[model samples]
Structures are given as structure tokens and as C-alpha cells.
Target chain A: MRLGKRRATPLPELNMTPMIDVVFQLLIFFMLVPHMTRVNKELLELPKLSGTEDQQESAITINITRDGQIIVTNEPRTVAGVVEMVSEEIRRLGGDRSRVKVLVRADHRGTSRMVNQVVSALAKLGVHQIRVGVEVPSR
Target chain B: MRLTSRGVQRDRKIELAMTSMIDMTFLLLIFFMTTGGFMTIERDLDSAIKERPSGRAASSDLEPAIVEITRVGSGYVYRVGSRELTTARELTDLLRKFPNKIDGAYVRVSDGAPFEMAAAAIQSCKDARFLSVAYVPID
Candidate 1:
């Protein structure tokens, strides 16, 4: 056991390399996935409220700017175009209208007519699983 | 320099500055955690004004409450089925007071009314928990 006594002491630390790599990967993933949320591209300030949460991964998000411009996945559309796009999206989902979920993220300054028009468009398409995004309440 | 147990001289321990890095990692983790990136989305369903409202959705047997939100210049006016009100709080109170009498909650905002006002109207209707919510055309 003299050889053991002569050896240098090892650092008794857990190997964190893999854990750090995973954390970095997660951070990058979170950063990239938010773009899918399109929260960055649409500069519309959403309505603020102490709201509940909804878990709908298959929802289509439509952004309505303050000046009444409608946006779907970064492309601009008119209120009427919104109907067509939603219809296409629903058809894209295998035409099961009930499976189509729509999310409307509008600027607080957006007109009620814009909101109404979106609702009407979805209504006409027979898709009622519509969700509207609002800001998190300030505590 | 330190001496080994074998009576040989050895170098001092090479310390790693991992404490600071771990602190920063934890800080980042906390940031992402509280920011709710994990949340699917914060949204609410507005199932109003369906083209085909479900059967057994008749509000005629029960008194329906129609809320009119009108845009007047930069402000707005709130009316509960012809009875004018000023704030959404008052509207909520009115609906809450006669919960049994009101079955349908329709939000009819003027064409130019802001979404904030419309959202407020929806919020009040939700608070009242009306049986049915319909969207009426702005006249």
C-alpha cells in the first residue's frame, strides 16, 4: 500500500460536463422554439389580464396588428384572406374541422371588428376551438 | 508546494473556478423556469357566435344578456342590453346580480371599438359565467 500513499489525491467532484451540455442544448432549444410562437415577429402588444392557460399544441396563431393588419405565420392577409387561410389550415389538418384550433393574438389597440372578423371567419369554417392570447397580469 | 505522505514534494491542488459557473447556470435556469417557456400558451377559448351552435343551446327560455360596447372617440361606452353603463366592473356586477335571469352573454362592440374594450367585455362576461356567449353584429 506504499504505492497508494505516494499517489496524488484525486478531486472528489461529480462530472458535470454532460449535465452542462444538456443545459446548453435546452437553452438553445427554448430560444429557437419561441420563434414558432411568433412572439418576436409580431410587434403587437397583446391584451393584458390575469388569465388561465390553455394546452393546445395544434393551434394556429393569427396575429392582428393595431392598424387592422392580419398576419399568419409572418405573411400578411386581409380579414377575408384570414378566412381562406384558416380554411386551408383546417383542410391541411385532414378536414376534421373540430381538430382545428385557432389562436388570435391581437394588439390591445386592435379594433373589436378585427377580433369579430376573426371569430366570424372561424365560425364560418365551423371551427370553434378558438383561443385569444393576452398578456400576463402584473402582480 | 506540499509534501506527500511518501516524504516527496508535490504541487498544490489546481483549483477550478466552477463555483461561479454553477451560480450562473442556476441563475439562467431560474430565469427560464419563471418565464414559463414550458407553458403551452396562456389562452382562453371564446366559443361565441358559432354558425352551428350546439343543440340544447337555446337561450330563449332563459333571458339573454346582450352587452354593447361602443367606441366614442378615444373612449368607449358599455351597455347591458340597452341599459348603459360606464365601466366593465359595473357590467360584471349587473350580470352577477342577476345570474339566474341571464343565460346568454353576447358581446357586441362597435366596428371601431378597441379590442381592449372588447376583451374587457369578454372578461366581465366570463366572470359572470353566462351559459352562452353570442357575438352580435355592430349596427
Candidate 2:
């Protein structure tokens, strides 16, 4: 066999399998790691209950700051104002009482008296369907 | 001239451009990874427990148990159905004594009771598996 001079070139072949594997790994990690929570009050240090995870929606939301001040969602409300607003909200909800749920989210350092006052006021208005938003990280 | 089969196979290398798609996927994965901790927890409180009428003792036969937590200076005072407990140790002991079944508990909280005391009280009642808890704030 007569041998002829041949050009020896290194093939620029990039391995696509590893790249695809890494991409899918990252995609799955992001998807499974997420916990999409809807309530957006500030970062209140809520107590950690072992595995008590209850998911429910509220008609109105209440936030009790670390210093124990009461705010109905974004607005700071006085006891009288809160009562008036809640009373009106009840009337607005009219037929579907199931929709009228009050969520109380209090800071871990927040006093319960303020929460008590709010609950008492709601009780007076005859709205008992209430949800206490808690912090449930795997303890 | 007709190309041979070997010539045709090596003549063209078809590749789908994946650089931009990989970049976009990486960006999304990073976003979700960083934002995974925004997890919120929701829990429902036992609905509208009828507080005992002011004049009448709670349920003549049952004699509803009450857990009183009052803040005194920087310290806290706890009273469980007429038994006073000044320390957390004592409170734990008292809770351990709770029966397997009970009607409900009335948690009487004072405005001065800080979150620590209030949380402890609520937790104790919950540990006892008390059916319901009514929070009453003393002015």
C-alpha cells in the first residue's frame, strides 16, 4: 500500500451529554426547591410547629407588628376603625359567609393581647371563621 | 458527478443552536433557587367559641379551666385554674398534669403579657390537646 501525506487535524467535538445532564439537574433543583406562598406581609418570626401545615385563604388580613400595633392589611387601624371596617366587610360579603375569613398574622415577638382584642371585636361582630397565619418551617 | 454515500455523510454537520436557550434556562434556575425561602404558612383557629357569659360560671358542670398569663415587670406570672406558677419549669409541670380530655381552656392574657408568655400559654394549651382556647384580655 503506497502511503500518501494526510492532514492530521484534531476534531473540535464538544460532548453534549454532560451539558444536557447539568442543565436538567439545575432545572429539577429549582422546580422542587420552590414553595410558592401567596401571603406577603413582612418577615414576622412566626413560631415553628413540627408539621402543622394548614393552607386556607382569608377574606381580610390583619397584621400585628412586633410592637403589638394592629393594622388591617396595609392600613393602621384603631379599634373603632377596625370594628367599623369589619362590620362593613361582613355586610359586603352578605350571602357567602364562607368567603368572610379573617387572617391574623402576628410577629413571633408580638403580644397576644392585640390579637385578642381583634378576635374579640370580630366575635362581637359575629364573624368567627378566622385563620391564624403561622410560620411552619420544617422543625 | 454523483457523490458517494461516505462523502454525503461527512459533507454536512447539522446542529441546533442551544447557547441562548441554555443561558435563559440558567437565569430562570437562579431566580427560583434564590427565592425559595419566601414560604408562608396558614392555620385555622377553632371558630367562634362562645365565651362564658360574664355573670355565669363557664358551663356549670365542667367549670372551664383557665390559663392566666400576666406580665409583671420583666418577668411573667402564670395561673392554671387557681394554681399559680412563677416559672416555665412550673408551667411545664402543670401542663403535664392536664387530663387526656377536657371541655376547653380560657387563656386570660393581660396587655403587659409579652409574646413569650402568651406563646407559651397557647403552646401549653395546644400540647394538652384542649378542644378550644378562648383568649380574654384584661385591661
* Residue-wise C-alpha lDDT for candidate 1, range B1-139, written one tens digit per residue: 3335632324444455576568767877886687665333345646456443223213333245667786556678886645667887888888786546345677776678778877777777777877656655463
Model 1 lDDT, full chain set: 0.67
lDDT of each: 0.67, 0.62
Sort candidate 2 into its docking category.
acceptable
lDDT tens string, model 2, B18-105?
7756876787778767765554554544433333323222322325556678655677788765566786557656665656445666
In model 1 chain B, the worst 10-residue window by lDDT is B53-62
In terms of TM-score, which candidate is strongest? 1
What would the C-alpha RMSD of candidate 2 be, to one decimal place?
6.9
Error of 2 at A122 (Å): 1.8
How does chain A of candidate 2 score by TM-score against the true chain A? 0.63
Model 2 clash pairs are none
Segments of candidate 2 deviating more than 4 angstroms: A1-42, A50-53, A93-99, B1-3, B10-13, B40-42, B45-63, B82-93
